[model samples]
Target: MVALKEALARNGGLWIGCAPEQREAPSNELVMHQRPDFDIGLFELEPPLYRDFYLGYSNSVLWPALHGRVDLIDVKPRYAKAYRDVGRRLARLVAGAVNDDDVIWVHDYQMIPLAHELKALGVKCRIGFFLHIPMPDLQTFKAIPEWQDLARCLSDYDLLGFQTRRDLSHMINIFRNTLRGELRANGTMGISGREVALGSFPISIDVAGFRELAASGADKVSPPPLPRLIGVDRLDYSKGLPQRLAGYEAFLETHPQYRSRVSLLQIAPPTRDDVDAYKAIRSELESLSGHINGRFGTVDWTPVQYIHRALPRTELAVLYRLSRVGLVTPLFDGMNLVAKEFVAAQDERDPGVLVLSQFAGAAEEMPEALIINPHDPHDIAQAIKTALDMPLSERMKRHSALYAHLESHNVTRWSTAFLKQLTSVERIGPDGVAPLPGSTPWSRTA
Candidate 1:
């Protein structure tokens, strides 16, 4: 969202999204903010529509299924219709603002079908779509009753972006299966007899700004009494919070000597509380945290310091700096930015260890960090022990490598690459230029 705002400042556009506090009626309104470079539109939905569109299909069906949990598929006809209805409603609001010359870039699953709707309404501009989350594996995606329709809608875009090569490959394979399109060797597919460019541009944080925040020493929170291992994620099932707590318990059990000397500080703010799955995950996580704390707590110390709230970046940076280890072991993720942010905020003089998940997209980028299976508590526990026991020289080496990569692959580079590609797509217009594909070239502009 920060990068989106910055891009809007550079090249103006409107951002329409859902924000309940901005509720005037069922219609979207332009948000007049301090920054005049861009416009923001917020719409409030009716209760049943909200329940189905957001909490129902988007979360219960698309989200879990996309993240490789097909059993969680809760597809209802109303939910699917609600999804389409919301897309059409959003498209109606967007239609008033867009023109033939403007580039229409849609984002994520909720807005997947918006481009097709816009095209149907005769908005003849180049449309691009980027999925921020991981694409589902072929079989898991097939579980969705409307998978074929969704895949067909995806092919309507000129270009598609994924966070990792794996995700792109998955999409291409799925397209071959569902769209019956021939997949080319260079990651293009013959979708409706035209080539659609597929590419991966891993997302990143503001590396320099985060490092400066680390340097500022502002908003520093009081570190835990023990040598802390930190886990920062939104409270969600895919984050593997329950497994992490179990791993922490296992770590305490297996390594009794470090029981009082070490602790896990987890900062997980609630997300999608309207959804029952999210609520269930929260309950399971809280139960696990309580059980672990009860099992391994002293009069003056606790084994886990779990904060169910968000923190300012300044404070988070300071916390990242102070911790001895970063535990970013999500069960599934497109790209875990917290892993990079932790590395970026580390003190090189006495850097911390990062225990990352092999399943996370960031794992592909940073091989130096200790990687483990997020599903296995034993594996997570073992990785924790390894991180806890890793030498200073090794820690410094890993941190330096991860930091160097983040410095080059920061968020600015990501946004620039996507937009530049979106603009440079092979449109049948006068300026029929194309961007260098495969991966985005790293940019170092201020």
Candidate 2:
């Protein structure tokens, strides 16, 4: 959402389509609400349509599939129809809102068929799509059975943005093998007469802003003096929260010397509470945290400080600054921004170590982090100990390298790169270059 907002702010003349419930009280509901930077309009769709179609099928099904969780995909006929209906509605809304000069930037899997719908409606704006999550390989993608249709639908967009080279490669491979599309040199593929450009533009954090927050004392909220190790994430299934607690327990058992000397401050804000999986994950995390604290906590100091709420940005920065180790071990993620935030918020004088998950997208860029396999409790335990015992020289070296990377390529840089590529693509002309045929718009299909 931040990325989309930033793009719109830069481009100007933006109409944001969201659920009606979200727009009722826009100030509190919007993520980056009070921006004076650009002319932005918010348009809300009916809640039932958004929830049943967009959130249900798009997020619950396609989101998991893209992130390599084929087991969680639920593709019902009704859900598929709902998905298509929502797309059509979105396209109609966009057609009414947009002008000739406006550039349509579609976000995430929720609106994959949106571009096609807009095209079918004869709205000739240059459209671009970005998938924030990892695009799974052919085998995982094909499990959907409706994969070809979806892929064909996506070809309606002039440019398709992915998080990494791996993601772009996956998409290209799928198009060539499954759909028999002609692959291009610059990560693009031609399918059903439409030319779609595939490219990697990694998501990032506001490094300088985070650094300022860490340095500032204005929003500091000091907790009771405790040797804190931090894990900041949304309480979601993919975050590996239960396994994180188990690893912490194992660490205490194996390295009894550091028992009361350290404590984990797990700042997990609850998300998607309406979803069964998210609710179950929250319950499991709470239970696991309770068990661990029960086993090792004393009256004076609890072994784990579990805070199930989101903190203000500055307060989180302060927490990040105070911590000695930032443990970010997600089972799977596109680009865990928390890892970057933790790195950015560290004190240069006495920098904290970041024990990151190998599977996280940030790990690929910031290899200096103490990478751990979240699936292995033993490995996580060992990584924790290693991070704690790491020498100042080594910590400084890793932190410096990671910080340099973050400073060089921040979120602003990422957004600019994607939008630049998106705008550079030429639309198919009327006479010689025809609009891609045989590609069904999402709204029509729905």
Candidate 3:
């Protein structure tokens, strides 16, 4: 939301959001709210449609499949129907509101069918879709119900964007191999009798803004008494919170000297409390945290601090600055901004080490950091030790390189690059289908 708002603030555009839940069905009109630079259009959906679409199909099915947890998928015939219904309704609202020349950019998995629905409604402006989550491997993605239907909807877009080269490849391969679609001589995919453009535009943080926030908050918040290993994420299965806690436990058991001297603080704000999978993960985390503390914690010294609520971003920046290690080990992630934010919120002279997961999208850009397999507790434990024992000079060198890369590929640059590519795709005419710029024979990246 912040990234989109920032982009629209600079180049004014409309933002659409669903309004607060209401007992009665809302009128077809879209509620309007004016911002300084852009306008927000709010609409309301009937309760059942909202629930089945947002929580049922989007979160229950697509979320699990995208995160590579096929076992967790909850598919119902009604869920898919409601998902399409919501898409069709939103398309009608948008079709009536926007002009034919306006560019429409749909975001995330929830609205994958938006472009197809809009096209059906004869809304001819160019449409682009960007997935903010990982595109699972072919087998895992195929596990989702109505997988082919989703793929067809995706191919209707003028351009499709992903967060990493790996994700882009997974998607294109799915289209070609599974859908039996052909790759054109020129780089576009010939699917459903139309061509589609694809690219990987890795998203990024507002580096300078985050750095200043950390610096400003440093004096307001007190530093930890002992060396602190901080992990901040939403309480979700994909975050690997249980694995992280188990790793911390292994660290304490393997190195008894630091048992009471060091601490691991995990801040996981709750999300999707209504989902069974989310509830299960929360219960597991609570049990794991309790077990770790009971095993190693003392009356005076706590080994693990588990926080279930969120902290203000300013305060989080302060905590990041004071921590000795920033441990981000997600099972799978599109682009974990917390890892980048931790790097941004550091004291460069005696900077904290970032022990990141190899599976995280951020790891592709930040190779200087200590990367470990998130699935292995022993690997995470050893990586933590290495990060803590690293020399000050080495820490400074790694931090410098990481910070430099962040500055070069900051969020502003990320948004600008994506918009530029979308514009180029639009110029290819009404269909907005052309060979991706700088296309390779089999693979492509932007």
Question: Per-prediction TM-score, please?
Answer: 0.92, 0.91, 0.94
Candidate 1 deviant stretches above 4 angstroms? 22-25, 28-34, 218-224, 428-446
Q: Write the per-residue lDDT of candidate 1 for residues 235-304, one digit (tens) a residue.
A: 9889888988888888889999998899789999999998888889988888888888888898977888
CA-only RMSD, every prediction = 6.5, 3.6, 5.0
Model 2 agreement with the true structure over 163-186: per-residue lDDT tens digits: 877788888888787567788776
Top-lDDT candidate index: 3
> Where is model 3 more than 4 Å wrong at Cα?
184-187, 426-446
Question: Could you give the candidate ranking by TM-score, starting with the highest?
Answer: 3, 1, 2
Give the per-residue lDDT of model 3 (tens digit) for 396-432.
Answer: 9999999999999988887888788777762334454
lDDT of each: 0.81, 0.79, 0.86
Candidate 2 vs candidate 3: the lDDT winner is: 3
How many residue pairs of model 2 clash at the backbone?
3
Candidate 2's C-alpha runs over 4 A off are: 20-35, 218-224, 426-446
Candidate 2 lDDT score at position 17: 55
Q: Which has the higher TM-score value, candidate number 1 or candidate number 2?
A: 1
What TM-score number comes out for model 2? 0.91
